[model samples]
Target: MTSLPPALLRPLLCTVVLSTPLLANAQEQRPGVQAGITFGATTGAYAHYDDKPLVLPALSWQGKRFFASPGSLGMNLYKADGLRLSAVATPYTLRFKTDDVNDPQLRRLHSRQMSAMVGINADYSADWGAVAASVKREVSGHGGGVESSLHYSYPIQAGRFTWVPRVGVVHSSARLLDYYYGISDEEALRSGLAAYKPGSATSPSLQIAVSTPLGTKWRATGVVANQWFGDAVEDSPMARRSSQTSAFISLMRAF
Candidate 1:
């Protein structure tokens, strides 16, 4: 199959995932809007990627229970109460200013360009926490990949804080894994690094978070998560042994 550039990929995935909404109980509350900020850092075993802090603003709207956003847009349509359908688009691009170490074994990797992606999610839940399965497809630019994951979350009360735990597993197609992990023959020659082999991918993750009520209309949450990439996805040319362990605190307001 021919590969697509990252730029074209995002919209392609979005179009494919946005199907006719399965209308059942339109009991979903009227759509609302939300805006917030997130900040956190990640660490891993990869050579080209390492621990870095991310500070980004988040904006989203929920309509009849469906959600969309400018940074990562998505929607959810509920069916029969416990079952739901969803889709998401997430893209990140930034220039690396200096050489960074690829932990465990220190190797220098540099990135000059980046791209975006879109994913599809299917979910089922009870009254407590829910189970969600998702798959991401890279569409437009040179860097593209496919990812699938299963996640579960539940809430608990601790002190004055509302705590939640999240867990999941992720798998990726070769093209998807390689795009992010594959180092090309041309790239190897230019960088003076060995040729890279992009492999199939696997990852499992865990997260714990605490959410606290600030007042009647405002709230805050602190989160920490750990992700482990499988060997198939980790052995690829473009593969980084890097895992993501992150912590972030964010404040939210609802209307």
Candidate 2:
């Protein structure tokens, strides 16, 4: 019953799903920026508290062997042909909902605030698709949590539109799982829910993204994606749903 990441952070996952600064040519040894606004909605266990019609300003920069986004930053350590190895840092997904929702049950749960995850990434690109693997640990959470993923994507260009279809599997550590899905002993007593602690778990994901030319120096990107929580997460007392899904559209200007 965990939630999809926030709108601004959602694209960060897409980058992780592809494992790099996608859309832009990574091997070109160039520097560029894309800036604009992205509006989107995320639906899942936290849907009641999370904002809909999410509006976030988007900014991303990429160079020969480095890239930075609102939620992540990385530098490539090695590159040959289309293979890359890099180090990266990314933001975490929080579990706390605000007081705006009228559902008292949802609001009583504890909140897992945000953390910065840092680790390494490996990516390989081919004509058919790209494959990537990454492992990161929460630096500030101090829970020694580890998150990792293996992803594959295929990009197709038709007319001025480019479509990327992606699939992946993600593994989250016990610390990460417990932080988001488990109720503490204190919380269980206060909220009248049994305390539960979960170990590591894995989840599968799928997504499709499309980008098309809008006008000179501008283009549009839209994406929809979903993640089905693993049993460890789905079985939590705080969990009321099995999956999280999201969609977003953005207009960008390249510089």
TM-score of each: 0.72, 0.84
Model 1, span 1-255: residue lDDT tens: 877655444333322122101000011122476556555444433445434444545454677656665345676655567787776765532222223433322233344334456777677778777787877777777556666778787767788787777787777777765555556677676656666766676778787777777786566667676777787655644444546455666555667
Q: After superposition, which runs of candidate 2 have C-alpha atoms over 4 Å from their true positions?
A: 1-30, 47-51, 98-101
Residues 184-232 of candidate 2: C-alpha lDDT, one tens digit per residue: 8888787786789988889998888888877888888777778888888
Global lDDT scores for all candidate models? 0.55, 0.71
Itemize residue pairs with steric clashes in candidate 2: none
lDDT of 2: 0.71
Ten residues in a row with the worst lDDT in model 1? 19-28
